[model samples]
Target: MTAATTAAPVGHDTAPTGHDLAEVGRSPATLRTFLHGLPGVDQVGADQRAAMLATRSIKTTAKAWAIDLAIRMVDLTTLEGADTPGKVRALGAKARRPDPTDAGCPPVAAVCVYPAMVPVAAEALAGSGVHLASVATAFPAGQAPLDVKLADTRAAVAAGADEIDMVISRGAFLAGRYHEVYDEIVAVKQTCGDAHLKVILETGELASYDNVRRASWLAMLAGADFIKTSTGKVPVAATLPVTLIMLEAVRDFHAVTGRRIGVKPAGGIRTTKDAIRYLVLVNETAGDGWLTPDLFRFGASSLLNDLLMQRAKLATGAYSGPDYVTLD
Candidate 1:
């Protein structure tokens, strides 16, 4: 089916009522109980569902449309110690014009960078429709003290980050210190001010599917605009099953809260086929609203190039090598 194919709309199954909201005040005990009470994730069922979704087939035209949509949803990123101003500018330029030869190519959703490079990215992406998202809060580890994490978040927002991707404290969460994790997220959300917050759960380190589900609920409860799967630093980054669990979390979170939260699967996803498969998962699981960049994003850099090559092939009926697209 084409990306434009319409699907039957579904309403919230368990939208949080006023009583539920009031019951889940900032109290850690209440929050912990609520999160722990979330429906347990059946790993076998979830893995089966993700595997089934990945096997979906799309025609050429539909795949093309999905490719463009995937490109638009990409958070074109560069988060390396070697990241320099010149490299950031080049990345911004590529994000703005992913396929310079084709005017039909759409700009990516945003340019993700380290907090210190936000100014460089801002300057490079100026006038482009791309947003600036920075990774902060002792990213990848989330091991630092609460004060330090908040300061990191505030500095990134001050540097002009439209979105802050904060990593949750896996150490605390694994230690069963759910309250500590929830409170840290709440504090960081406040520091974000107008900027959006995307909380990374680092699912790989979370151990089981159950912890991922609980962490998802905890992040959403603490006021994350988007719930992400990983920090891209761990050995096992984003995976289909992990991402599917996160998507289900957002879908369920919206049901009770009447709030729309985004889901981002970062790290390992690197092909048009993989991205389209994810879009299919979103379409079937979260409904239509989450299909947009506002509610969904792919945290990727190399994924863009493969998409460009595929788009070029579709346009010219010829294989365009890596040389055709800008390398960032």
Candidate 2:
């Protein structure tokens, strides 16, 4: 949990340990065999682990630290059809100065928006120190052709996005076209250039924990800087069990390849308590190394104000309401 003032350069390699060099240039069949061979997940054990971690409590000093850390790790996202330049600008201002009354409060990690809104978001966040991220590759659906998806990714990068959150072709993955999903991520990574790439698995649609584990490996093996849980548009977004699986994948991925990949649990996480629970999961499961904003993030919008209100309570010894904070 470094200070929010620390600079977060896009595509910065946080883990220098290194990955399996041999796995880097393998054929599609070889890679698939390697990923599938990686042990299967025991759903019951994973669920118990997640449930047990969620009950860990924090209070007083630890509570305050978790609140601030959660604030700094937020993506502060706003992805909707009605998004406007004014809305994006307002969101950026909020990200830079989350609490107008309390300058000590840390700003959010980044601002996430649709590809069409990248220019507006980039301009709004120009000198704010908060990075701009765009969702490309047809976003929530990811049903477009490879060329269209690549073009969509390039457009976001050209518009000054520091991070690109691309959705994997779930249809291909489910259809056993693992190579197609892997190649798409590889191509998108090249298109990203200096920008960091986050591959979203959309776990709910994937159907099983085994598929989730396999998808996690597929994205990381193909060079995804971050492996995310969902797009927030699906029936089920980020859940404790699903997130736990991704965290385990990253931990094991680092153990096998010695490379560190970030994990983001987006959507449905709107409360300060829920955010802290996820922090506990990260601390216990992935170890404290992933506790920083760079290696972990919450892709959420409403969660920001809740955290601010909790921070205010810690300082003033009183609870606040929506009227006390901006509605962005």
Candidate 3:
């Protein structure tokens, strides 16, 4: 794994390095000029590279470490209308101890739930090392007004959520209203207070890889700690190619600004093999600095179960059967 050259950590307090970058989002024209000035993504090359990386194999001790790392980097999520307090609590317990049978198993990075469920998750995860993340800004579809979105963010933070996963205004972004999107993210970040802000781009609706790259840069410039791929509600959620582009964006952004932001590929990522592939992507594209949960995460619920099942198999040298882990 290549070491990261930048020193600025995610959420670092220092100002951005360059004067132009520091003045990036001051106006719509500047934001547009900066975003459009970004180097375009080579869609075909990106796809080929991701596919090639997916084929790189990790085995034995390396595979074991990858599984454990993937487990720790997971944002165990339960974002549904039917989510109950009991369900949220149960999920929190799972996040705290993914493998109840093995005390050596590490806890997941965080527990993500809706705003209404934030209090429940907070109560369940109290004093636990795992973080509590809540999805605000009208969640799956960011159609709500700015004031409502700010209120939603404030409510979640007040309810004890340490992390806020907000969705950018796809409508405004698609319409070329880059400043509006940037301002909204800024407002949401302010309302988040000390809570880390994760800006979800909903890349499936982005229509193209260039737009995905633009949205990623916009989120970071607007003070997003992490630029997420999807909400997992859309039919076409996180993809390796899309995530690769995001990784590149963070990598370049860090090279310029000295601020290392995080990247998360939520949804459609299940099984240990899939998780390992993403790990490889991070190591190759953004270097090993992002291997930790602080700079990388998998926003998934079912993905944890698969990691556990694979982990058990590695420890015992036998498949733990279909009933080895609970179904999320």
Q: How many angstroms is residue 178 displaced in model 2 relative to the true structure, after the best TM-score fit?
A: 0.4
Q: Which ten residues in a row have the lowest lDDT in candidate 3?
A: 7-16
Cα lDDT of model 2 by residue, 1-328, tens digit: 3221221111112322244436543676766676666667777877887798788888988899999999999998989899999999999999999999888999999999999999999888888889899999999899999999999999999999989999999988998888888899999999999999999999989998889888988899889999999999988999998888788778877876878999999989999999999998887777788998889999999999899999999998999975988887
Q: What lDDT score belongs to each candidate, Candidate 1 first?
A: 0.86, 0.87, 0.90
Top TM-score model: 3
Q: Give the lDDT of residue 112 in candidate 1.
A: 96
TM-score for each candidate, following the candidate numbering: 0.94, 0.93, 0.95
Best by lDDT: 3
Query: How close is each model in CA RMSD to the real structure?
Result: 2.9, 5.8, 4.1
Mark the regions of model 2 whose C-alpha exceeds 4 Å error after superposition: 1-21
lDDT of 3 by residue, 100-164 (tens): 99999999999999999999999999998899999999998999999999999999999999999
Per-residue alpha-carbon lDDT of model 1 for 1-328, expressed as tens digits? 4333332222123334547766674677887777666667777878887898889878788888889999999999888999999999899888898877778789999999999999999999888879999999988788798899999999988888989999998988999888888888889999999999999999989999989888988888788999999888889999988887787777767776688999999999898888999999888777777889999999998999999988888888999865887776
Ranking by lDDT: 3, 2, 1
